[model samples]
Target: MLYFIGLGLGDAKDITVKGLEIVKQCSRVYLEAYTSILTVGKDALEDYYGRELILADRDMVEQEADEILKGADVSDVAFLVVGDPFGATTHSDLVLRAVNAGIQYRVIHNASIMNAVGCCGLQLYNFGETVSIVFWTDTWRPESFYDKIKKNRDLGMHTLCLLDIKVKEQSMENLMRGRKIYEPPRFMTVSQAAEQLLEIVQNRRERGDDLAISEETICVGLARVGAEDQVILAGTLRQLASCDLGGPLHSMIVTGHLHPLEVDMLQIGCPGRNPCIKYSYQDG
Candidate 1:
């Protein structure tokens, strides 16, 4: 049997009891290191799991997944994902492979930022299609995500922006040289995402295009969610661009049609809220 288990978005103890039992019994356990991350490091997880885990980078999971699936027919192999196994498409592909091979697989679920993001006081049902904001290179800037956010906003729904994370990425120079060298990992912060969003909006307006969103739109910046020191800041997009939430693993929400209850919740939840005053374009 092959077990795909989810490690919730926190420290080592976040693992479910069933997941821990499976981890201890499996002959091999591989931790999916990319896509998402926990607040703690590998050593911390190893100490709590009582099992040394093998780190599986993107290349291994994408190009060499069969290696991880080997020997699964005869023995139990465990694949540990940082969040719910299905949160990433790669894990879904893994499930298909196991099915084709006639190997039985079970998914052990846990909370990911997708749902856990509600801790900021936005109701879960109010969220629309989630958008992923990626790091834009000097020569490669994509703005399609802005359209999705506008669509959500027009429908009076919130937009959850999942920031990009680069891990074990290879530079073009090294790739052409056939070198295996990898660059350092980088996690996008809420400020960077907000800055990119602001630039996109500015570009649209400069082209004489009207936008549903603007600098004055209410936005929420979240960092290190599900952790003891998590930070949630509510303000305008302009305000969020300069605010520092600290550390990696940040997410942002472009709010729409806020209920009084949500405003109260956000104010109560935000330690730095100054009891944040909600702003809207209409206030102008």
Candidate 2:
């Protein structure tokens, strides 16, 4: 049997009791490392779960999936993910492959960013389509996510901006040279995402495009969510672009319509920031 387990957002102890039992009993356990990560390392998880873990990088999970599912037909194999296994579409493809191989599989779901993001006080139902912000290069700067944010803003729906995480990524030069060298892993900061967003807003202003998001738009910055030391900061987009929330694994929310209660809750997170929160409706 193939078991796809969610490790939750925080630490090793965050694993569900049922999931922990399965991990303890499983013969081989693989941790999906590229998509997301936990506050603790593999050693910490192994020590807590009382099992050895094999790190399944992007290449191993995508290119060498057969090896992962090779002996699953007979014995139990566990695939661990930082958040819900289905949070990333790639894991769904793995399930499809398992189905085609006639292998039995089970999914143990847990809290993922898709839902845990509500901890910031934004109603989950209020959020529209979630978008990912990737790292921009000198030659390549994509603003595809801006349109989605605008669409959400137009509908008075919240926008969850998932920051980019580059793990075990290789540079084009290394790839072209057929080298195994990997670039340093990078986790996008809230500041970085805001800078890109502000740049897009500038371009829109220059081109006379419809403006829903602006410097004063209410935004929330989250860091190391689900951890004990997790940080949540609420401010304007411009303030967030300059504020330092500290640590990795950050997420930002571009708010649209704000309920009275939401405004109060988010205001509490703003501390001393002025004009704490402003939504799209305020532009009117």
lDDT of 2 by residue, 1-284 (tens): 99999999999989999999999999899999999989899999989987789999988988999999998999999999998999998998899999899899999999988899888788999999999999999999999999999999999999999999999888999999999999988999999999999999999999999898998888888888888778788877887899776778899999988988887777665323334333333432
Runs in model 2 with CA error above 4 Å? Answer: 270-284
lDDT of 1 by residue, 1-284 (tens): 88999998878888899999999999999999999999998899999888899999888888888888899989999999987888988888889898888889999998899999988899999999999999999899999999999999989999999999999888999989999999999999989999999999999999988788898888999888777778888889998898888887899999978988987787677544434445444411
- After best superposition, candidate 2 residue 48: deviation in angstroms? 0.8
Clashing pairs in 2: none
The true-versus-predicted C-alpha distance at residue 104 of model 2, in Å, is: 1.1
In candidate 2, position 78 carries an lDDT of: 96
Per-residue error at 76 for model 2, in Å? 0.6
Q: What would the TM-scores of all predictions be?
A: 0.95, 0.95
